[model samples]
Target chain A: MATQDKREDILRAAEKAPLLSPSAQRLLQITSAREHELMEIVAVVKCDAHLTVRVLKIVNSAAFGLLYPISSIDRAVSYLGERMVVGIALNDCAAHLFDKQLDGYESERGSLWRHDLQAAIASREVAQRARVEINPDLAFTAGLLHDLGKALISDYLRGTCAGLLAEIEQNQVADYLEGERHLIGIDHTEAGSALARNWKLAEVLQMAIAHHHNPGAAPPEHRPLVYAVHLGDIIAMMGGCGTGADTLRYPLDQGYGAFFDLGGEDLAAIMLDVQEEFAKIDTSLAETKEN
Target chain B: MSNIIIGIGDLGASKGQDDILKTFALGSCVAVILLDPKQRAAGMVHIALPEAKINPAKAQERPGYFADTGIPALLREMKKLGCQPNARGLMVKLAGGAKVMDPNDTFNIGKRNILAAKKALWAFGLGPVAEDVGGNFSRTVAISLATGDVILSSPGRPNWKL
Candidate 1:
């Protein structure tokens, strides 16, 4: 297909992308706010009894191994915390996109989700340890959705994986994003940004999806969050949880140092934490999927 | 054939001839494939870092996550499979350790990991018989115990035996 045609196809698909669940929409709206109360989050979960049940189920699942089962939705929210709540809601609402196979990238069915999960955890870790006052929960949300654009563009990228890698290696293109644009006239970031817009994600999240690979381009206020996701994404790839071919093709903006004052040791520690969190979350979520 | 997946920071050895030890998403990480041709036992360690000194506690918890500790951990696991990793009888093949983006690599971890794996192996009087390392892409590698075959695969690339 011509590049223009492929671009049109991806855009149309993004335009037709399914809307986020009402509960997820509300959750994002509440969490993305600069000053939202925990009760607000609890109220949102309570509105959807089924979501509350699922949340409690996940918290009580072997993933957490809590001593006693928590019967209250508020308790579940408090225990699993913000990231876990957001993750469960997103996974339940967007299973079609999250669960689809990325054949173009030669990635398995669950690889994209796993990669996002790791990035989210790493991003949260970065935010917690960042030099600035970036919101860790927001960082986790942005990280979780950073590579969502890949699902939208994966089909368009089928059979072009080797070519993309070669072009990237030869430096014929700047990076994977450029390779995507060169081939299809559209990149995963753009595709995902469009989806984020459709979902009415927060301005910070939309900016993150748009410029995760280039945090230097984000607005001054949101730049640190984008940097957090960028570092988180790299950390995930380094941890060997990439979605496939495009795993680590994007370059790191060393400029991130201005936002985060981390060293090799800090990152190594964060990776250890991410790995443990991922194993538990993935096992719990995988069990949920199986059940 | 049963595919035994060795995850990041974890290693497993199998004496079952039909078992294949496999690891995936090897970006900036290294996979050390060991085959004891004599005992028909094989193991692979997915090494994620060059040194355990970054976090000694983590290295102690998951030795397979760092090259310095991973090599010895993999050898110990292989030993449990009833195989001796002697210099003459063991075949070492290395794959992965690709630089994943960033020209000004702050960590330059891929290079460090490659060297660390080699140094660790050399400490045991072993060297790789075959290797396909240092690139700008992720890889999924598998080694069969039944045939001691090392198959390396990447997205959009033809699968080849190393």
Candidate 2:
């Protein structure tokens, strides 16, 4: 259980795990949206034929919260908007990459989907409050993808989730990072950072993903976005709107206080808004159950 | 061993007895605690919003979730229980006011709830002894009347005793 050994173990496991570079690369290329880059993403998805199918599946999936189903990829792109389409493409690529079910993480098939949606919504709302020049799209994308490493970890670890959960319960690990560090040899932050690097994601996003659990660990320049992801992760987990092993952990890093200028009442309002949104999602969950 | 459990959106407990005043999943909702050690009685309020002025009627229905109404109401209840405000050794502590919104994209509800609670306490000449407010995490907050210790639990976080 030594920290160094644990780190080594995690590095070994991560080394053997299938890299998400392909999906990450696809996302980076798709998100570019510049003249040549946009054409590249569009052409890649359009030409691949497989991605087109995956995009259609995601658009029509109940996970998208869409009222009506669409037929074609171009139509789906048009209906969802280019930005959303790009976001959806990234989501689909991630989903495809991690096709196998993740062990140790609790939640139904679409729990990850729900978590992504909630984080995106929460991120957009928080950015507005801070009056930061956040690309709602970027925030949403980051929020949705923040936990990508979780899926990778779960898939890679095989059956380690149950043991990890036991440790979390026994030690009262409020955050999964502790458990991940103890059991898996590497935490999601490092793995996520590696994946981000492999995918050629911007340095800021990679840093944000790595330091999301504790944005204060990152430098001041990257603090804003990482802080957003941290908040998004906390809100999503607390809402209980999503299912995952993380739902059990209630982490409160003291460093979180330094990130923002929030007082007690504003904190209350934020919780209220989060709860309000959760209520909406809860209704949806109920409807899904009723159906 | 018989502990009184405070349900969601509600707070009720007393000191010297095994009272557990709690608020579940407090997002932007404020859980305010007033403890009178001498009286050995404690009271809590789970305010849903920052101020009562937003909707007087709704405040009347859920007085526990508004700053203007809930704070006063909890104080009155504490006084009725013989825990006179400022008369007995009254110590106020506050928790819960989580930001469900993103730090970048959402309105600052956590900050708003804390501010409103502070203002209400200031108006009533009360101040908090300790506090843990404002974050993206949803908090399940409880107060132990036996020791007037406030306990908070959140996912992937440490518990705090304020």
Best by DockQ: 1
Measured on C-alpha atoms, candidate 2 has an lDDT of 0.62
What is the per-residue lDDT of model 2 for residues A171-196, given as tens digits with 9 covering 90 to 100?
A: 66644687776666677778767667
Estimate, for each residue in B133-158, the C-alpha lDDT of model 1 and write its tens digit. 98767788988877778899877678
Q: Show the lowest summed lDDT stretch of 10 residues, model 2 chain A.
A: A32-41
Candidate of highest TM-score:
1
Candidate 2: residue A117 lDDT (0-100): 65
For residues A86-198, could you state the per-residue lDDT of candidate 1 as single tens digits? 89999999988888899988888988898999999999999998888999999999999999999999998888888887887678998889998999999999999989988
Name the top lDDT candidate: 1
DockQ-derived CAPRI band for the predicted complex in model 1: medium
Flag clash pairs in model 1.
none
Off by more than 4 A, model 1: B53-57, B85-88
